[model samples]
Target: MTVPDSLADADGLATFAVATVLGFEDFGADAVVEAVRKSLPELADEYGEQVFAQLSSALRGAEGDGASPWSRRTRWPSLEDRVQRMERVEYAQLCRVRDALTLLVEASPALALARRAGVENSDVRHIEAVRALNRRTDEYLRRAEAVSRYPAERAWKGFTGLLLHVCSSPGRLSTFQQDVTVLDPALNDVPGLGRRVLARCMAASDGEA
Candidate 1:
């Protein structure tokens, strides 16, 4: 399908690329395109065109199929190389957020156990560790949000919220684990873009943990 005239600019084109990726994952392309068109004005208002361009370029590198000009892979040896060339600061911020999320996910089981045990004196060290990790995650998230001009802020908030919920409530850990498993492909596909997109979609649907 041809891109609409309204969506022909940098911001519009980036939104279109996001819709295209989401379409490939779930809804049909036509539906996604239409939905994005309807939301174009709001999205444009919410984020800067440059941020959208960076996100679109990241998505393109992630797909690596050359399906369209927007998604054509470069000769760079790695995705990180391509991202550094495009926007080094943004890439670094995203990497920090990604690493923080990964650490939180890895420590989830121990966190849950600590929460379940009621944080006795013997568990003080474990609780302190969890608090430190939580603080680090928050710091990274804030850094990412400061640099992002789009939904990354909301996505990270939702992700952190889910992580807190899972760690605090042992009963929900299994469901959280399952959801993360389902999102594993996306998480692995792109350093930060995939996680941001998936988390934003989930948050929009009120699917918290």
Candidate 2:
């Protein structure tokens, strides 16, 4: 099946759920956000803009019950409404991602990949949800990395900075851990690269514990 149809495509959904979780566990939310942001380009302008708006706006909405992207999931929220709901949606989505990531870290890779596919909806472009996302993420990372003229430090920081911001949360370490595993270690600016995210998650867990 084509990329758009892959949302309902069983194989594609399965892979995405696993991979998204895998990405979260290993890479963190900023990385996941980076990955999702990277994938957003494939969403087409209107929806892409709306979705991205929701992602950012929603993250902010978490400051209050001000209706975030997920909260705005009425039959069809307007672009503005979707933007309002972004924070709630982000919270829910991030939690789901964390749960998924936590599972991958705990279980075998085969089991992680074998779970049943969730009911993933296609984005405005109508590609299978996860497939479309994964496609865009890979493309974004590649495009960002293809800066031939930029110095090595600039190029590397460009991508890593994106990962750190988008994936960061109060105390979620999984995303950070996974990201550093893949990031260039030569750069020293990011001491204990994922430390901030790790600290955030560790603090949360400690509070709960």
Best by lDDT: 1
| Alpha-carbon RMSD, each predicted model | 18.7, 20.6
After TM-score superposition, the amount by which residue 61's alpha carbon in candidate 2 deviates from its true location, in angstroms, is 6.6
Question: In model 2, which runs have C-alpha deviations exceeding 4 angstroms?
Answer: 1-16, 19-28, 48-50, 57-209
Model 1 shows how many backbone clashes? 0
lDDT of 1 by residue, 47-156 (tens): 32343454445444444443543344222225454334335334453454445456444444333344444433323343344445443233323333333423667756
Q: Any residue pairs clashing in model 1, and if so which? A: none
lDDT of 2: 0.37
lDDT of 2 by residue, 1-209 (tens): 22533333444345445644443334333333444554334433224345655554543443244333345431334556544544444565555544433322222222112222221211112222222445433332333334323577885565444333233422222333433223222122223323433454556668779
**TM, every model:** 0.22, 0.21
